[model samples]
Target: MDAASRQDADTATPEFTLRSVLVGLAIGCLLCFTNLYFGLQTGWISMMSLQSALIGYLIGKTFTHPSFTPQENVVIQTTAVATGTLPLAAGFVGIIPALSLLSQETDGVDALKLSWLQGVEWSLAVAFFGVFLAVPLRKQVIIKEKLAFPSGTATAQLISVLHQTPLPQPDGLTRRRGYEALQSDDVAHEETRVVVEEDVPQDVEGEVVKKEGWADLLYSFGASAALTVAAYFFPVLFAIPLFGTHLAREWLWSFSPSLSYVGQGVIMGFPIALSMNVGMLVGWGILSPLAKLSGWSPGPVGDMATGARGWILWVALAVMVSDSLVSLVPVAWELVRDYTGHGKREGHEDDEEEPPERLVPLKWVAWGIGASILLGTLLVWVVFGSDGIKSWATVIGFVLGCLLSVLGVRALGETDLNPVSGLGKVSQLLFAVIQPRNVVANIVAGGVAEAGAMQAGDLMQDLKTGHLLRASPRAQFYGQLVGSAVSIVVTTVAYSLYTRVYEIPGKEFPAPTSFVWLNLARLLRDGSLPPHTGQFMLAFGLVAATLAGAKAHARATGASWARWIPSGVAFAIGFLNTPSFSISRLIGGVVELLYRRHLAKTHTPPGREIRLIIIASGFVLGEGVASIVGLVFRTCGVGAASCWGCGTGICAGCG
Candidate 1:
């Protein structure tokens, strides 16, 4: 073939096709709604990239003529995950609800109300700046520093595993010869290098091994979805009375038959699950009883003040804050050292970086960042009012957001935990001083930080996925842009719908994260906490620090028992919610242990390596989608009470 024809053949396959974008939008819209529903209920938004990529792959394979390529799957997942995170990005699960609670406390005098139009505009304004912030850092973080970004890395590995077939070469060209031909150009050379040297799972001379798990995945998905649908109607099925009906109802100690919870535990694995169960036992079984007996918290079970739930929240927040801050010490030190010329070396002189032409242009990204900052400030002034938040505070908040997002990215890259909440608290503290005694200003400023950290970390993670797949960074950026636009509408509408249907911070929809934000803002404003909560907070903070230190040391020393070390973060999560959630998670952990110790040896199913992940993902996805569907059902005047749930009284402790 001639030179032009050869080059055209090399680049024939498209990564950013119309079908990819359309399919991605559809998936993203579903995930956006699902995440909002799930996040409000559990205070956790499960990662959606792997699920999206796998589902997108399945859909393409089943429906599309040519089938979806690995690069296209990367785009689909990148868009979908970014879009799914919108609820958090839009502050629906955290700041917005927190602000609403605060307004209620102040008798509607300080409410920062927004119409649907304003909500869409506000979310749009704050979201894009973070995407812009992530662009320039892609090379430094993903390529040069080679930060793990575990979720991103895992997604990339899955994609590679899914598309392990030998690349289609020219009519008679050998595999090596085809690679050599692509190596003539700089961009193609970089792609060829990574593919041949790092990513390709098979040898040049080896036969391609096709991996198939569609039948198993589909079966599990259908089963999980059906269960989810059934549980919505019955509700009592998931609230299993494992510890007698009284303790299950009053102390929230039931074993949940929730596929979603178990699925989460499977992904989290045994160590974290054990920690969460331990936390649930200690916080609910031990501490909660003690608190009630001692009269520290003597109100009803669900009361945010003078109740077991309220008391434990402080303890959980203390653990989470201390653990997150202590964990950041090592990362912070490295970042400081890097700036001071003593950083740990990551790459060698021989390493080849992607060509400039393939990167998101720095000049345009910088302009976009600046533009987004102005837009954010303008929106804050308009929505919150100039009196509520000064123009200067908004600018400072965004700057602080950008700075903290770097830390957020570092944590996410190293440990797969974006400490957005902890980082937001930092912003809240700063704003407490900057806009003293102003609760509205405090929460809004913190919103900027949380949104920035979340969006920046999310985009960076997506970029890392693209990097591994040899997908164009520019295409991924565009995909993110489009997905973000969809998120604004989806998240706002979902939040609006839910608020109309149910009272937030109520029994059914206890938004845990919002309470954290609300309590902190209240403490800053009122200069006090409930009862003897201060003592408990101090004690738990120390324990959290100790556990965090121990975990870090265990990992550093490569201890044999390191894997058994309880994660402080998981412990905090356990403390944050009801025991039913944690108990269900432990069930999944037990299953994981069984699978590891016995099932793997006994069962050699097709796609044995990824079977667990597929099944677990199905459970999570099925429940999330079903929850959204249920929400719609409730909104359409089909009250949940009409079902065989708490209203019909099949079981005692439905809540």
Candidate 2:
């Protein structure tokens, strides 16, 4: 809060410190474990943006020197979010199971078996493609076009609020000026320098104590971690049910509370919650049950509903691709026009401020991608390999990946929907045409695009968060780059541990995305689908996808009524995963809505919303910790069947 501290705050020296990297890596490991567990459990991956900033703010306060800036916390979060999201985004869990399944199915496929080591390398390599794509495109898409990445924007707001410690510079009012600059949403550093040569203004209450901010963060962290640890051990050791269940399930049978799912609902708000409920209701309750009654469904009600969701999936993919085409035509035409001098070329705005310093140069990024590709090609050749076709496959696959990466980011910015799984099909179709018999080629080529597009889109989103915070792109790039390297080891361990403990694609963990990808690969190879697939109904899906895509395009372009179009991704995923999870989300949405109404009706106090949200976020994080501890004991061979007992579960009775 002093002048010397303010000067330190204004500089960027501490952004890449040892403490930042280590802490970021540690948090990234925890999130990597959490995301890996949940992706397989629910066919969805959790993000670490807000959670990282919130926790980083705590460390910045009680842990770090008073001069720690907002940008430094951002550096911490960039790495954490990168490590957490990239595995799922880059197709680690989804593709790995498919590879494992294929290795078992084919006679010589065991030669192509993906070890955990290969999994990490492949993830990192594909992510390299994403980085190359995002780095250059950040200016074009985020700055010039100004896409609406809501989550990223929200994170920027969070950073602004939480990192308002010890203001910068007495004479200049630097902290206040810097914040006002950030409000532009397309801000540059020059816009932020409003100097006032005077002593720093004091609050009405006099010499302001900043310890309250740290206290709030610390208490919230402690309470959340405590609840999480308690909930975790009790269920395993004492057989005391902690995971909360829903409406009628508790009356009829056993269940556990998933606080995390509910928290997701709270974050996503009503539209997502409503969509999930409707998807479950229509797909699981009515249609799937009816199909079962008529002998048209398979397995359980959830499994049977997946058959209908199969119908939805293809339609969604078709619609998504078509929507991409609709937007692409105009952009393509404009580019052509500009190149041909058929239209006036727009110049950069003279009023705009200079961009912040970049850490990784463009040349370095380009070369890094090219080199990583070559190394990746060699590794792939050495592993499940090729007839001199790996490099060719990688090059072609990466080209298409760049296109899909652009499209995916644009679509996500517009509608928060990116058909990441769909990106794999571009590779599938390309390989199918080039050499239909090359199964390894198909998986590798398609996997490249899948990983590249997903990562690129993820990077673009993160950059948007950075852009809003006026954080340096280079600093974030370095953070993520190191994080990706660290993840190669940690994620591999987590994936191996989970696979060993619980069989994926099994009764407990369905791994629905894995099944989808594997079946697609099968369809590409033999033009056949497993029994209960309803492959005959794909035509219906195609038509539905086209119509839905048209509707979405309309919605994006300002046809508010078109918002009624059911999201293909959400609909299919909601139905395919357990109905109870969706139900929990719906409950969270209801709670959030009611709380909002209460605030409006009674006019709540200043910190009320913040307090409630902190508690809720605490529960969400606590659930993640609970999951980690449970996994730890399970990985260590603790639990039923491991211990010889009157009851195999972890009770101490009857020893």
Could you give candidate 1's per-residue lDDT for residues 509-540 as a string of tens digits?
77888888878887888778767879988998
Clashes per candidate (backbone, < 3 Å): 0, 5
lDDT of 2 at 299: 41
TM-score per candidate: 0.88, 0.78
State the TM-score for model 2.
Answer: 0.78
Which digits, one per residue and each the tens of the lDDT, describe model 2 over residues 187-287? 00000111111233322101111434445444644665565555444433222223322322221112234566666566555555676677567555554
- For model 2, what is the error of residue 4's alpha carbon versus the real structure, in angstroms, after optimal superposition? 20
Minimum summed lDDT over a 10-residue window in model 2 is located at 182-191
List where candidate 2 sits over 4 angstroms from the true fold: 1-14, 103-113, 165-256, 297-359, 387-389, 437-440, 529-565, 605-607, 610-613, 640-655
Q: Positional deviation of 402 in candidate 2, in angstroms?
A: 1.5
| Cα-based lDDT for every prediction | 0.71, 0.57
